[model samples]
Target: MKTKKYTLLLILASLFVGCEDYLDKIDNIEALTELDIFTDVNLAEDYLDAGYTYLITETTAKSNQPDILSGLVMSDEGYPGRYNNSVQERYQSYANGDYLFLMDLNLGVQQRDTPNLAVRYSESWKGIRVVNTFLENVDLIENADEETINGLVGQAYFLRAFYYHLLTKRHGGVIYLTENLDLNSDLARVRESYESNLENILIDLEQAIDLLPVNWTAGNIGRPTKGAAMALKSRVTLFAASPLANTNNDPQKWVDAATAASDLINYASQNGLYQLIDASDAINLDVGHGGADLFVSEPEKLNNYRKVFVGPGKSKVLPQEAIFMEVNDNTIGNGGLVPLPRTYLTSGYDIVKGNFNPMNIGATANFVEKFETKNGLAIEDDPSYNDQEPFINRDPRFYNAILYDGVPWIVTDSAPLNTSGVADLAVINENGVLGVDLHDPTSPANQLWRVRNSTGYRIRKWVPNGFFLRNCCNAEEDFYVNNMIFRMSEIYLNYAEAANEAYGPAGKAPGQSLSSLDAVNVIRNRVGMPNVNGMYTGSTSTLRERIRNERAIEFCFEAMRYDDIRRWKIAHLEENKKVEFLEMRWQGGVSAIYPTGFSFENVEQVNLKKTFIEKNYWWPIPSSELEAVPDFGQTDNW
Candidate 1:
């Protein structure tokens, strides 16, 4: 045996090393082939390890790479300093200037294009190919126990489903592949026939669900658990049933979505796959007050997501919201990341503050607003809530997201600042967009949206803790701040949405009951927000809109909003939402105006043409893929 040619194992665990210290060089292991490796379980494990490299391939934690790349980043959410290159790409698409993406442009009203779209798709396909290759050869393992064999196969199926989920989320009409398909025959265009692909994916996912174990023990932290499988099913089904899927008014898809989501939620609630973190400790855990010893500062180890992002407090390790996260060390070249919305800050400089910049994004408010309820109506909706202590009695997400005028952070400034001017500091970067004083004090370009080298008061959510400057790869304290890819709260929201849609299919109704509504209520009551279907709101749209708003407010800055909007297909603000401003006369007769708008049109000029054709309901099939296959063509309008 030639020691088995090549096998990828690091994908199975925390084995694929990306970071090397100053004195060390990353061991350049040539991609393993079947002939080189796979002699035994050890080599098989290596291949499994390599398979998961996708999860931990760290980008610059603080870099703006996610500004345009992440599925969750809205078009206008790209900040002033970050994604500067994207401005042209975005603008050109609006002009209907290219032949390549007009088909894509015809999808939605947006003018986005195929190049970037293709890149994302290509990346997904590459991973899919790797997993497919792994599945083809895994059966070659010698004398493996049936249980072990099934476990390995289950994981392979789950991976295939996972890849399909990503493709469907982005392009919609992805091709379905199976074990028996001829390789060349399979390489054909099927983007137009997305329904079949989705059906294919659903069948694979269901099989995976049956095969995967309910809970995984040690050596499986990073592996997809039964909960993950179901969660994905719920998410994908909901997507499939939604307007994005254009189910032709077939309520069956909705019923299917609801059933999957409800089933997943029930499993989670029963199995403790997810548990809500205490509200106060969701962000600011009282360690001295009996906080788990494990959460001294590095709460990431706790493996929760709620506390780490929207939640408050200075936890040493994992914030409470962790559901699933990729662990990174110095080996990954500084890749633990955070996606700060354009207006996320106590003011302009405080990254931790979540709500103060409500009006920063001109197109869509950088911050999603939760209104104070008056006569059971959102105070903002009633318009009278603004007059009565506007900030009081609003969504708890505001507190979780914003530090207000009185919040504080661990800043390098020796200045003795209370929370008073901290909020102002976040917004007052006259020098640059995210810098200290580049405004030229003369040119309009030097104004609000410009980058301030000194970093002005603008604190971006992407700022890794303790990073003062950018390096190719710098080890920062952010490695301590756990990266939460999924959390319990999200699972709850998933449950709610799924149940609302799934009711009838499960021999239930489309509204919340204890089984479904309990998830929503738990999160709502935890945050001190109102329940969705109650006597305290206006129309059903009003209440449902509140639900959507709560999800955005709760999941803000966590890379969920972009997809949430897409899945819901709600057209609020394209990039960012409107910035809210209130001219209030407080205490004295003298009145003052404060800006709260966070809309996107004010930020960047986004055309959204290439990705937005009248019939272009899906992202384009990448142009590169088109050339590879004889039958592949463009998407639609373009």
Candidate 2:
């Protein structure tokens, strides 16, 4: 019989080694062969853990990759603060109707070594290959019990489905690779239909749900559980039922999607495994500063929403609200969504105070207007809303998520400096000078420039009260931020969307207890906001608009807006418009009612109107992949 030698080392080394010499060099490392890895349970598990590295991290944003930013700047949520060469060439060009296939051939080939969206295409395939190799050989393990084997196999299935989901969502349909194909096997394969791909993905998720535990304990907390599989299924099915994929507008698709979400909601509720963090408990805004109010209002509801992102430390319990997340330690690159601060006093720059990349992402005025008033009325509909005093009496989430001209933030500069140790406010005077200056300047600049708030607002959802850049390096502080890929709030929103589409806004699905209106109220009531207005809840079309706006507020800067717009088939209408910014002029006589004392004016962003069209709905396949398989043509009209 031929000697069976599994090339597990070759699979691991392929990530770092060159394609030309990887096979030749990896065989020399003799200890990592198939027999050695499978016989030892620890070695076998280590092979499974290697697949998890492909999961996204905070460094993806800092590296300026297109995957994370494509969801932010490419949508109406925000734009880059500095339109430098990198941002203009890669991000701006794509947003302005330049075909991605052309950009892939030009820039993607040149910067193949770096992390970009084009590179992400190849990375997902490599991850799938790694897990497929493990699943094929796991049954041969000599030292593991049935429970151990089941867990390993379940994780392998989940990882494979995750990679396929990433590819399918971005490029429409993809070739589903189930087996570990050798070099001699057939390499040219045609792409499958979107429905065919979704069926295979659901099969793997069902297997994972049956084999995995409800939740992981101690050292294995971050791994996927049965609940994670359920949550992912909810997301996947919902996307498939949207207008982009279900172009036929099938009613059964929406029903299937609603049922998937209802399954997870019922399981979680019955078991008491997940619930939204109660808003009644007040969060201390002044952590180290002696319980001062710091002029920040509505601490109870604002901080309740804030705690979902800046999670409790790893030693303590995970936030019950976070269903699944990618957790990190005290690493400097872990500030994923937190914008770079505006000045040195706030630790915006590095330790030496030289490297400064300020506010790479800024929220647009168009997105800011989506947050309704506290009475659940649009700014135009509510008589209480005052355009002159725009920031007052809005939703508590708006205060927590946006950093406008005159918001209070924690100042980290110690004593002896002028604004040290107090919660300094972000003040923009009549001349438009920001209160905080650039790192080298002694005072605020004459005008807003690079690394400053460009779109009239900076994102503050992920940046907690006491957060600072220096905390990323200080392990003693025990500061950690999680990228919440899946959370309980999102599941509720998914159900509401699908339920409203299948049944009317006030109607429930066959067996579900809550109506679509009830599902949305659960999210709003948690944040002390009022229920949806009765006027909009009478029909599906009117209530659909309200549901989309709610998602924009609840999941802003969480990277869901881009896909939401496209899946709803509204990108052509929403994306083809100029970016708007708010300019504030201080009128001087400050009062308790109008604290900022500034008059706001809307201005169109110069030379930055987005140009999305019909072909922009789905990304094109890369040239090299299509070249390899002539049968696999490009996406429609690409």
Candidate 3:
């Protein structure tokens, strides 16, 4: 038995068949020891790969309650649809704080039936331990050159900081650990202050930036780059400066965040690491499935915005707009959930038993109201916004992001790959018993008040059109959708937000070449939306509202809304209201063939009511951790 503080026994055993078998094969293959692992560059790299494996990209139906989905569902952005009883209860827990679950390492295991909103504290601790173990042993690797050593070691540092940031953000001032702990090591530790925790995180990120290269070769895609570290620093500082962390709402923290974001922007620009993808160049019409005229009319508009999320559509390679993302080759590391149209669409598509169901999950009606008109005016401000015809004359992003009633929908076999005249349209409206056929309730287009969309709208941001429809029909089929973690557009918004906070909307910071308006306009111009500077002039507070609105519009359903509202310290205001859903009244019957449009007359509240108490700003510290280490303290109000 080894007496070293850390042991590689269990981790190594997990990588192989059995511990005894691994030991027996060591003579034929390679010796397995801490010294052996450290001395061998390949073994050291394997350890880092283990560390990276825990990094989650998307919240799928299987692990139903990641913060990416929960955050939005808990916030005003999403409405719970056809989830199971546990998921429904989880949504209720978020709203009223009625039932809270303890965090466990095996929380999201398929065997476990209960839904868990919290990330496993134990898993996060394990991740931290893995990173610390790497940092401690990396120096012993002599086979690799200095640059290679630094690059790998720097990733470890960045990952350590990343896990710590997640912990601090979820449960403020968690027990901070750097060294790898073993059975004999002390486990009890007091919680650190949020400021101190952020400082430690920033220190690791700074080291990562200093050591990591700006860009890696094509072979090493998805590895954290220097820009990723810098971007992370900006995100951390931004959250730290928010009302939740900064009780006084410190002005200097805003400057700090602004400076950090500016550092990334300046570095990426100087190094030529990334740039905003031009709308024209971003469009790729080579879809796997779509009607002939799908890309024929206004192809530039349909293909431009969605291509960034799914890579340049045809080639499906990472666009320059991507700062850091998980690389997927369709066969492995891809999400099993297909985001099927039945969940959102009310069209006549076949639903094979065990293959697909109309599992409802759509955007909230309130979220759809945030989009601006094409003429740079809000729906409320623009006289052109017709409540009778709400879908028309809206932002182009509306078409890019949503598949509303009357919009083109090309289901499998409904349209060939090249036919372009027009595909079938979605029929998802029924006012009371008039529009729906009570006699034929099983019909696809008939109104489904029970299992259909809670909101009148369906999500279209991640859903690809045309050829993608045929390929992504069921979970068994593979859909290589890259779960985007961070993008350059988010950086632009972060800078605009921090810059506006640091130095009012119109004013520029010391090193800034453009004001907050210019930064926002860059994103707007990409989508062909009218510039913000030409709109109604307002104070810094007004511009602040516009910036927040822009973020909501640009990043809807991308899993950033929950944190955005909370960090802004407005969760209590926004979250407590009842979730609203748009109910349209079709002039023609639901079974009627083709219709021009429907009227948005019945916008009603959902059954669920969200309640955000003062305690909700920070998640509750899991009872398991609190009980295991008595010295560990609970988050306030838990």
Give, for candidate 2, the lowest lDDT window spanning 10 residues: 343-352
Residues 343-436, candidate 1: write the lDDT tens digits: 2211122222221121122112234334334132554456545433334434444433332221234432322122232233223222223212
Residue-level lDDT tens digits of model 2 in 71-190: 566678876654332544555566577756433643334442232455556666777776876777777799888988888888988888887887788778877767765645555557
Stretches off by above 4 angstroms in model 3 are 1-31, 57-69, 102-117, 280-299, 311-316, 330-360, 413-452, 466-480, 533-537, 574-576, 588-597
Sort by lDDT, best first: what order?
Answer: 2, 3, 1
Deviation from native of the Cα of residue 409 in model 3, angstroms: 1.8
Model 1 CA lDDT for position 426 = 25
lDDT of 1 at 288: 24
lDDT of 1: 0.44
Flag clash pairs in model 2: none
- lDDT of each candidate versus the true structure: 0.44, 0.65, 0.61
Best by lDDT: 2
Please report, as a residue range, the 10-residue window in candidate 3 with the lowest summed lDDT. 10-19
Candidate 1: list runs displaced more than 4 Å.
1-36, 55-80, 83-118, 180-192, 280-306, 310-321, 330-366, 370-377, 382-384, 387-393, 403-406, 413-479, 502-517, 533-542, 572-616
Clashes of 2: 0
Worst 10 residues of 1 by lDDT: 14-23
Q: What is the lDDT of candidate 2?
A: 0.65
